[model samples]
Target: VFFFLYIYIYILRTIMANLHELPGAQADSVPSAAKTLVWGPGLEANIVLPARFFYIQAVDSSGRNLTASPGEKTFEVKIVSPVEEFTRIWIQVLDRQDGSFLVRYRMYATYTDLYIHILLKNKHVANSPFILNGPVYHEGCDCPQSSGSVWETHMHCPQSFPQIDRDLALYASVDPERNAQEIPQRFGQRQSLCHYTVKSNKVYVKTFGEHVGFRIFMDSILLSLTRKVQLPDMEFFVNLGDWPLEKRKPTEKIHPIFSWCGSNNTRDIVMPTYDLTESVLETMGRVSLDMMSVQANTGPPWPEKNATAFWRGRDSRQERLELVKLSRAHPNMIDAAFTNFFFFKHDESLYGPLVKHVSFFDFFKYKYQINIDGTVAAYRLPYLLAGDSVVLKQDSSYYEHFYNELRPWEHYIPIRADLGDLLEKIQWARDHDEEVKKIALTGQQFARNHLMGDRVFCYYYKLFQEYAKRQVTEPNIREGMELVEQPSDDLFPCSCHRTRVGDTK
Candidate 1:
């Protein structure tokens, strides 16, 4: 009986010991895998200059570190190819006390490609490449500081500001039967006569041909600034250019609000305004810009596309109407149709062979796509070029932010504003199939590289920085939460673990 009791006690103790080891055994059985790499706090694919310090944290599948020792891990940061000597130095890895690590460096100019690599116990853990856009500042240039009088000068308009009312009244009195070219040109000429130039320091504020609405004008300028710079609220920093003008006209019970239009006031700014600003950027609202390459993913491959040239738009301008006539004359070569009758309800009878509206993506089905300007440069140019179709772009006086950077014929086939050479251009493209395809490829690549939302943001950031320098008084915009409550180290890691390297305070 004594021997049996002793054996029973030993068995019970053995079971308890195994149970104690169960937790450790289960932990060892689970696979420790690093899943994703995340950017630092408030850090995105777009990074502006003077923002040198930020971190990239690597986490396991469970969102926790597999190990918490710097001695047991490896971290490296590298600026990707075409790296200039100016950007080569100062990029270094900080001690990874926990799972989180730091990459600190100052950029002289913009860099689109930057990479980070991490390893745990000699095994590759995480790798990522990101974009950083910096303002181009030249050394030895005596840059003027911002001041008060500059704001007054930029906001001031010509003495003939009241003439806009007269121009509108005269435009209304003009006979609708007048030649299509006569009305727009006559109004444009009158507007040009009414224009005046105001200068504050070296910066000048001049009028464009027509009056773009106050809301659209203000929104576009702010969007370009906010989309790129993570700075103070521009609303707080700067006064609306139109607000002062409106206040000055106290006798007018109601200010004349113009229809949506484009601006030459923003010409020096170099970026063009899009009709879809509200839909695309959600600048004033919460709309997120869709970054996916829609043209490549949704459109049919180049080989399967139709050989005919295609165009579609509302009857907004004389050039567009001419395009419709050309399409009807050469139906086989050109497929053009009215997509909307919103602006020209009375002219419905004039439209012949109009088809139901088709999605913009459908335009990519044809091998050749025609891009013509609406009010200014048609905002669709970028979206059209994104596709695999070769673009026959009508030359216009208007240009967008990146228009200066693009090469004609190399990136797209250029046609005159009159579009008289449309048929000839189409035939040339048809005969040179390989060359047309190459142009399409080139255009697509250019759009992807330069017209991406991140790239656009960078362009605006640089423009605003330069614009701000011209001002006599600094903008009075309110600072954001991130800037106000900047972290103790001046950097915040998304992860809980953090290591301090220097006196960030």
Candidate 2:
């Protein structure tokens, strides 16, 4: 038995070494025509694509000696997406070392380039008027987003088919602060930082992924604004801050919007700590607007652009400013990518005894652009698949909606989310109040497990730590690893990451 064990160990090492020896053989499961990688950087970066084999060939652009590993290592590249030009990357052959003839790309981190294709001819929209490209409009927005929407986005005139106009201006804004002085938000109305009406009938906002804390931060600010305003409006305010729930054993500050209702503490959170009051709302509103303007270079009499995006350290905190017109450009596309957003839509349920609002949340990776495709078919800088309950678009508007201002994670969750009286309809529960509690609990648990950072961080940390420690010399390891010191820069005192190779699998 001992002799066999030794032979098996030797064979495993030999296979690993020989795998690198065969240059033409691609690793198992990497793709040939590289699609977007889920584990790269930014929003979709957190997702993992299936392993495939492909070829890696790099050219030195900066005249710096190319650094790479013979086997597997993560490498960074300035992916010129529009032109498909990758500069300053070291190349290697990714082939099957399994002794099989079939070879593809695998191992290490490679750039996942996402492209948007808009084949719209000017004649279509010019000839006919349509409010938004078509979701069976007038039929009702049944998607997850529409489920949470407060007002209508468009109205269909029976006389004019296909012609749709915004039912009400759910979003509004005032420039220079003076315009806001005159316009009074209707009594019992909440406004976005941009001054847009926070409620829309055609839109049902479910989650602002990555905009606020993945664990539930920034939510209280939005709901608190209605309180700080004038008399009638203030009386209808919703208190998002929950104090009683934070007193649990672990003592976690629960965000307003959580993806998990299945968890206990994540159930319907009520109570206003009053810590995040109206002033905080105003501060958040102003700060977010500033971030947006700066990101887009929206100084008057100048073209708006992307922010000066650069990581404090490991080259990840990207801040760019560009115009929206160019955001959805195809293949080698360039959009004013200031921040990233994730959107979703779901059906509305009237089981109100406890579940007040069906919830969603963002994962803080504020770097991407959103191009609304359909109710569920938009293009993002990175990539994400469609999910049930919500059709989310990833873009600057989406990003700022929930993540602008403080950190990439600051956001608005359940505070004033328009539930449309969904909670007031729980009729058949064994216990009236208990049924409502069950519903709210369902949503909270989902956020805790799927959207919350502590939830994600714990799982990812455990898995990554194990893998990173297991790796001897692989580069571009994600944030946490025992062997690596956090990557840092003098600019942002808080921004840091682990310096490991980029993943290609």
Question: Residue 272 of candidate 1: its Cα lDDT?
Answer: 32
**How well is each residue in 443-496 modelled by candidate 1, as lDDT tens digits?**
977875655443443443343333334333333211221121111322211221
The deviation in Å at residue 164 for candidate 1 is 28
Clash numbers, per candidate:
9, 102
Which stretches in model 1 have alpha-carbon errors above 4 Å?
1-268, 275-293, 296-298, 342-346, 473-505
225-248, model 2: which lDDT tens digit per residue? 211111110001122222111222
Best by TM-score: 1
lDDT of the candidates, in the order given? 0.48, 0.21
Q: After superposition, how far is residue 240 of candidate 1 from its true place, in Å?
A: 11
Q: Against the hidden true structure, what lDDT does model 1 obtain?
A: 0.48
